[model samples]
Target: MQANYVFRVTVQLDPPTAHLDPDRFETVCRLPAATPGTDGWLFFQYNLWRGDIADADHMQSLLMEKLGVEVIEASFSELETDSAYRAALESEIETDLSRFNADSVDAVVHQHLGSSIHVRDAEAIPDA
Candidate 1:
């Protein structure tokens, strides 16, 4: 029922802020899998290209908002989804093949996610 985008962030602390606990962090943010062909469904399809963030500045802004901190560096990790959720997503995609302009669900998934999608058990997801 859920999919999350994983990211790693590093926040550099200036000398005056050196006493802060940590500078690097890893976190997951839930991004619900909207039905296929919707605006929400374009998030991954548009924002990421070739397994990388399409716009560093845009991603930086997103990280700042999600983490509520000044991020020195940030990188996308993966789209983690459970098997049940992935199956459901594929089923939904099957219903809207024309919107994706793909012949099959697998083609649409590959077009959008590239090679960054990871199917895992829900219990394995760490608390964000």
Candidate 2:
């Protein structure tokens, strides 16, 4: 049995950035629980991305240091299966067309750092 966990995080960027290089814009970080000898608590994940690499790094560091997000990780694979990732990308196009001209900052954040964890065989249980 396998379980998939997808985390959606919202971040606000000071200077708006374009999504030209979506691959370079996104990253993911994982923070394990702090309880002693605890098998399961919770894994906190964050996605950070923008137009510039420097901005992405700054956000990553902030989340790790100030936001109490530890065990930081970075990767592009997270977006492959994330539903929010797809939605966010689509939202960008919608925003671009809408008259309100609303900026999709939330989608931008997820586009950069969103992640998904698949727990292998974690859902299997023996019959009692």
Candidate 3:
């Protein structure tokens, strides 16, 4: 069965030094967060999947493949799917309901990264 999931992913990476762009960092890595915190760590949120979700390791790899940056630290936390949460998500991200249908972690991440806020994973509450 497919279900909506919230994934909070953080990655540390070095700039594309070999790209020949004058903006590349010499040695230090870059953590580009859309909304960096005081510590400068970039945080990402995506409404992903659970049964076929991308574990930290897989996320690390995909980031490397797509962005050419190494993922140093990564973590996953589930978010609640309650109505209140859903309403908040709608207001915050305006997410497309169909994305929850992604069949793999790769698909989910590719579709939602850079577009949503930090999302956590959670077990579904049993229907009363």
Candidate 4:
């Protein structure tokens, strides 16, 4: 089964050195509209699949590093999907697995499910 996951991340600029003018700042950032009620603040919002959540952190880090801004707030706006909302997630998975010629969803899931590795520390990840 597949579900929709929406993420809304807001960031603020610390400009590194001199303060940035919104117009000039837009050159580096694609969505250049200034966040309401504040200058040098911006937002990035999107909807992705639940399985892609881990990749989202990598995306956030990349954006923060690329734009030289810090993420002030990050949130998941919507996380549930119903029968009324139909998507092509299965086909997408098929396309992704085409290189391996995975014949079906079960095949793909079985092939990759346990491949991801996890590490443990004192806090978030408990020792096995």
Which residue pairs does candidate 2 place in steric collision?
26-112, 27-112, 27-113, 47-113, 47-114, 48-113
- Clashing pairs in model 1, backbone N/Cα/C closer than 3 A: none
Question: Where does candidate 2 stray beyond 4 Å?
Answer: 1-57, 66-80, 83-85, 97-128
* lDDT to native, each model: 0.70, 0.34, 0.39, 0.39
List, residue by residue over 1-128, the lDDT tens digit for candidate 4.
Answer: 22323335667665557775542222222222222223421121121232233355665676577556675444434323332211233344555566546677556433433222222232432111
21-80 in candidate 3: lDDT tens per residue? 343332322223322122321123331333323466776676557446555644444322
Model 1 CA lDDT for position 113: 70
lDDT string for model 1 (1-128, tens) is 55676766666544564565565554444445554445576677667765677788888887778656776676767778888777877887898789778899888777767788898888875545
Off by over 4 Å in 4: 1-5, 15-52, 55-57, 65-68, 78-87, 94-128
How do the predictions measure up, each by TM-score? 0.71, 0.25, 0.25, 0.29
Global Cα RMSD, each model: 3.5, 15.7, 13.5, 14.5
What root-mean-square deviation over C-alphas does model 3 reach? 13.5
Candidate 4 minimal-lDDT segment of 10 residues = 41-50
lDDT of 1: 0.70
Clashes of each: 0, 6, 8, 0
Q: List the residue pairs that clash in candidate 4.
A: none
